[model samples]
Target: MEYREVELPACKSIALIAHDNRKASLVAWCARHREALAQHRLCATGTSGALVAEDTGLVIERLVSGPLGGDQQVGALIAEGKVDLLIFFWDPFEPMPHDPDVKALLRIAAVWNIPVACNESSADFIVASPLFAGRSQRMVPDYERYTASRSAR
Candidate 1:
């Protein structure tokens, strides 16, 4: 597939997601980074969003519950280039009924070439990076080129 560069604005649109078992940890992490995170646009799956907002007092756009299609919502936003970063704290030990949705969300984040942090350590590193607070470029699939090539076949 062909690729092209896209810019991520300094004030990025960040998506947060956390499994039931990891919600507390995610909330704590958010609280720790509250000051830094306040500068960005934040969204999350329902319960996690509420918890984070309550604990950190940071505004968050809440979507449906994860099992109720929140993961897909975030994935769609990522695909549309509306989300610049993903901070998902999923539990590896527990089995989720909507596991396919979780996998698909992660897959789409990779496809869109967005920065993703699946755990607190990675999230901390990403937040601490210079790129996180400044404009940055990322290579993504050149969809128009791929479509044109396919149409010419």
Candidate 2:
């Protein structure tokens, strides 16, 4: 008899990024995990977001393209704890002019303790984790409260 393990889907705000050449792979991966990913909020760079959104029929909050600061925008979200996970499919074989931005975004994710997936395998590991039990990360202590408290001090 074969044993089957069940992975609890976690509700996570995820950022999806891919280079132009890898958009197709990203889309395919998203399609395979659409059911799980759909339970969470999706944010993506313009082109990758469009591709994933189209492929999975899931709504993605789109940001500017990577070269146009989309990576920074998502990085800010991670820094503020707005995002839970990041899946970036970069073409390491090819050098990108926007490499700095990519590195910055990746660095920010690390600083914020956000999980990142640079390939399909890593993505599978994340989506299959017990922590991801189809539960959303609480957004407590709203931004307004934090800002107000800081101002009072």
Please provide TM-scores, in order, for all candidate models, with all chains considered together: 0.98, 0.81
Q: Candidate 1, residue 124: CA error in Å?
A: 0.7
- The per-residue C-alpha lDDT of model 1 at residue 5 equals 96
lDDT of 1 by residue, 55-133 (tens): 9999999999999999999999999989999999999999999999999999999999989999999999999999999
Cα deviation at 119, candidate 1, in Å, is 0.9
lDDT (10s digit) by residue, model 2, range 1-153:
122222223566889999988999999999999888888889999999998998789989999999999999998888676787899999889898989999999887765556789998988998898666455443223456557778999
The lowest-lDDT stretch of 10 consecutive residues in candidate 2 is: 1-10
Question: lDDT of each structure?
Answer: 0.97, 0.82
- Candidate 2 lDDT score at position 34: 88
On the 0 to 100 scale, the lDDT of residue 101 in model 1 is 100
- lDDT of residue 41 for candidate 2: 86
Cα lDDT for residue 142, model 2?
Answer: 45
